[model samples]
Target: MQHTDKSLQRKVNFLLYYAVISTSIFLVFILSSFVGKDKNLTADEITVKRITVVGEDNLPRMVLSNETRQHSGRMEGKEFPKRERPAGIIFFTNKGDECGGIVAATTAKDGSVNHGMSFTMDNYHDDQVIQLLNDETYENGKAEVSRGLMFNEYPVGSNLNDRMAKTEELKKIADPKEREAKIGELWDKEGAKRRMFIGRNVNADAGVFLYDAKGKPKMKIYVDKAGNPKIEVRDSTGKYKNIIQQ
Candidate 1:
């Protein structure tokens, strides 16, 4: 009877040990499931709270509390520091995929926005007007503006004098009927096409003019608010072709 009692107690101990081990395994699986659920946080979702600007002759300055930089992942602002003559008024914007706009204000000796021109660049192809001064005082400044076009080189067309000379030469060679036909063919071959103009803006308030080989005005483009020139074209019948903005 004592031997039987020892065997039953052994079975009870074995069952208790198995119960504890099973409970531990179940608890571990439950805990792992709770920790592994998706939290839904990404790197792009994090915001940049501040931006640090660095420039010449100045310590690094941090501009805080700007929400514009947070959304676009960049920062831009203006700083006017009191210093000696010919000091530059620097405008800065931080780096990102689509960075913020730049507000470059060039000041004269009196610290005013020089000649009412603000230099800026919004995109890659936009024309940026940069002032060329004789000295740092910004005296005797000249304005030069440029427009961007697609082609690498500008095409050539007939000049007014050359067209007139061609007409005269054709009259001498053929009858009026044949001369008119030849002139039409020449116009179709050379006169109907347009030329491309590409250049960078050198100064503000400067206008870029596009002319045909005949020295006639083809288009007049001006700089926009973002410091980029807007090109306006017209058809022969005076209808608008399209506005090209850089």
Candidate 2:
């Protein structure tokens, strides 16, 4: 009877051990199921100051935000100071450099109302090479407007950092005359050149303006707001003389 009782006690202990082990594994599986499944939520509205979209490699590829929260663009791993960017989307290149973006803004300041929108495509490591823009500034009863497509040219292989450095160096010159001369030299040789402009100039002339390699106005093929047509070419005196209209 003693041996049988001892055997029965051993069986009871084994059953308890098995029950505990099975219960622990079941609990673990239940918890893991909750953790491993993806949950989706639907929402009607979401408010945020900024949103950054990242690549699978965890680097930011795009960003949308207000100017206050906008990321200052970077080139060559160096970021410029935060500038007055409009509310819109900014894009990044594979190298994490600011490539180009779309922006729009309206504001009233100093008794003037200004509104503008722009879409730009930048050159590699440089400023905007092409831009589509519409802009207006209104004061009292008058308005100045610029609306059109523009194309700009930069020095081949010139980057923003080097350009900015040269500009800053020029600013340190104490003599106003010497500084002005140096500035003219810098601009005449290596400045950002306006290659072409197709839009309404400040004078309310809607036309295509062409420039030479030195960015001197070469031709004007446009009509004024008053319906005056001009197909003028630059003369030796550096003036636009109407050839077709005359």
Candidate 3:
């Protein structure tokens, strides 16, 4: 009976041990789950090279980065290789395509200044269609400033990859005449031109300029530095048909 008592006591101890281990394990799992569910990280100041905001599918939607660490842009699910860019945030579409963002900064060195900013929004699968831009450049002892709103054209159904391929093909052309002809055919498209410009031109004229689909100037209403206001209109052939000055 003493031996029996000992055996039963050993069984009880074993059961107690099992129960303790199982309870500890369950409690640890519950605590870890609560810890994992905590998604917020609060801090007063955080410094990093880049911060990427992702969507539910774990794809980056926006990235704030320094110039060196900026995200290489994407097009139609393909990412371009890394390139030098100004420090800024890069906006991406939901499907991971690059849409647009602010890429503006100023750099001055050795008596030369390149100061400007371009706030641009791009087309669905193409380049910038509209922008607010400011450019100030002082190089080789000459200074120029251009600030304005501009609208560009992107041919419907044009693809960035197609343009890139065209550029590559142009590079392989051996004949200058043939290359120029190819350029005219490739670049001179109905919807691939600067359609409107409203700002200070390089010639220091502050005004609005409209262009046709072929990028020929169709109209201009601007004022010179001396405050002379002028309006000019062109016919279908882009010849000046009327000019009014005040």
Candidate 4:
């Protein structure tokens, strides 16, 4: 009977131990589940969103809808000089949420000009759409050409001025035939590097003149409509290479 009693006690102790271990494991599982729930709840509560200003209504004049993906506008006028003809109206939208108005301008009617010159004014109130009329002047109430020339946001010399300078330089060089040969050689060897550097340092539409070996003007290199340098070779047979923008 004592042996039986001892055996029964041992079984009870073993059962108790198993129950305690199972309880502990269940409690740990419960705690982990609670933590997971809290983490999921926290994640669900937080959210982020991006707001983009889009459409033709968002851009500035001289900028085309097809040319730029987001935010663009255009305006045109014939009142300005032929070379300074307004290309179209442009609208610059305020990217910041703070109180600000859209700046607008118009290009000269004649598209022959290198750059359009016109200006307009705009006002800014909190979360409001600012509209500018094409006929209006800049905030300072002056014409675009009158204010100053800006390449991107920075000021630079005018296209007319640049052209005149290049022309003067060409005149200084004497032999036209030799100049052509030199320009051809340069284009074949170092054209890409030189053009890439110039495009970076100056306005997208800036013009550059190339002279031949004899120091005479051979061809004119200027930024094309797409803002890439368009190099014209004097000899139709001359080979030219395209520079890929990295």
Candidate 5:
């Protein structure tokens, strides 16, 4: 009976030891989980060089990007100018073409300062047909600023890609002048004519200039630098036909 009591006491001591070890391990695990884990993140601003918003098809639909990484304008069957541009937002059309964008730039170098912004809408397969723009420049101790809205024509039935292809064909001409003349003719035949202008000119004068389809200025209403307001009507040849002043 004494031997049984001793063995039972030993068993009880062993159980207590086991329980202590298990509890210690659980406590250690809980502490380590709290201490070794990362804290919840909080931030006020996130900076990035470029961001592209893609459509459901995983194709880029809009891009907010910088100059160096600017997306070259996309045309399905044609190649286009791939030049560096200012920081801007470029948007793609439903057909996956580069359709429009707003871009701005500022430069202060070599004692000259200049900045500008343009908001443009492009025609299919073509360049900008409408633009709102403001540009300011200071050079040689002179400053010039102009803010304006402009409208240009897009060939009614021609795709821009086809026009680009025509330019390539012009290059096959052996004579440089002949190629240039042909190119100019092609542009005149297919390019959008600047048909309207309204806003402040470089002289800081306000004006509205209206052009005919052939791009001849047919009417002008303006305030001159001397604060004189005038309305000038012109013939299709840009010859002044009448002048009204106030």
Candidate 6:
């Protein structure tokens, strides 16, 4: 009888152990299912100061924000020396450079408002080989705002960084006159040339102005707001020869 009782007790203990193990496993699986469940979020409104979109390698490709939050077009770890621009979207190249952007601003001090959208292509390691732009600027109490589509070409330099460094060095000059001369020299080295303009001028005239490499308007197809049209022919030196009116 003692032997039989001992065997029965051993069987009961084994059954209890099995029940505990199974119960533990079942509880673990239930907890895991809850943890893996999807969570959905809903919101009525969300506001942010600025948003930066990152590329595959986690580098910034684009940014959207207000003036204070506007990106300064910093690229390749080099910062361009400039002030805060108005609110707009700034785009970055795949190589993390400032390719182009759309910006607008209103200033009380200048009593002016302006907006511009532009796209640029890089050449010789510097931007401004070709530019497509739509820009407008209005001054307080002005008769008409200046708005236009412009194609521009900035003279290329051997090195952008070197030229920028030279500019910074020039800024350190103590004499204002000397600094001004140096500034002119800098511009002469990399002056921007307007190749074409097709839009309304500030004088309320709509026209197409074709320019020469020296930034001279060589030919013009002009039309006033009054519907008067004229074609002006110019010489190689941009001297006007004849005007055909319609």
For each candidate, what TM-score against the reference?
0.19, 0.78, 0.77, 0.17, 0.76, 0.69
- Model 1 lDDT at residue 190: 42
lDDT accuracy of residue 42 in candidate 2: 55
Task: In model 3, state the lDDT of residue 63.
Answer: 91
lDDT of 2 by residue, 1-246 (tens): 999999999999999999999999999987876665474445799899999987766566899998899888878778888787788999988777888999999999999999999999998888898999999999998999999999988888868777778878998999999998997887666667888999997789999999887777899999988998889899989877888745
CA lDDT, every model vs. true structure: 0.44, 0.87, 0.84, 0.39, 0.85, 0.73
The per-prediction tally of clashing pairs is 0, 0, 0, 23, 1, 0
**Which 10-residue window of candidate 1 scores lowest in summed lDDT?**
124-133
lDDT by residue (7-98, candidate 4, tens digit) is 99999999999999999999998788767734433344533231244444543233322212322222121111223223332343434212
Highest TM-score: which candidate? 2
lDDT by residue for model 1 (1-246), tens: 999999999999999999999999999987776666563335655455445555443433323324333222222222223233221222333332222132223455743224332223322221222322221223345433333332211124334345545766877755778888988766555443333333433443234546565434577576644666566676677554447733
Task: Write the number of the candidate with greater TM-score, choosing between 2 and 6.
Answer: 2
Give candidates' CA RMSD values in order: 21.9, 7.4, 6.5, 23.4, 9.8, 9.0
Please provide, for model 5 over 111-210, each residue's C-alpha lDDT reduced to its tens digit, 9 standing for 90 to 100: 9999999999998778888899999999998999999999998768767888888999999999999999999999998988889999998987799988
Q: Candidate 3's residue-wise lDDT over 1-246, tens digit each?
A: 999999999999999999999999999987786667564667899999999998877777999988889888888878888888888888888888888888878898988999988888888888788899999999898979899999988877877767877877897889999988887777666236888999998789999999988677889988878888888898866576437733
Model 6, 1-246: lDDT tens digits are 999999999999999999999999999987776665473345798788898987778777889988887887766757666677777788787777777776665444467766566555545445565555556665765544556667767664545666777888999999999998998888666766678888877777788988888677888888878887878878867477547733
lDDT of 2: 0.87
Error of 5 at 191 (Å): 0.5
Any residue pairs clashing in model 1, and if so which? none
Candidate order by TM-score, decreasing, is: 2, 3, 5, 6, 1, 4
lDDT for 194 in candidate 3 is 85
Compared with the true structure, model 6 gives a TM-score of: 0.69
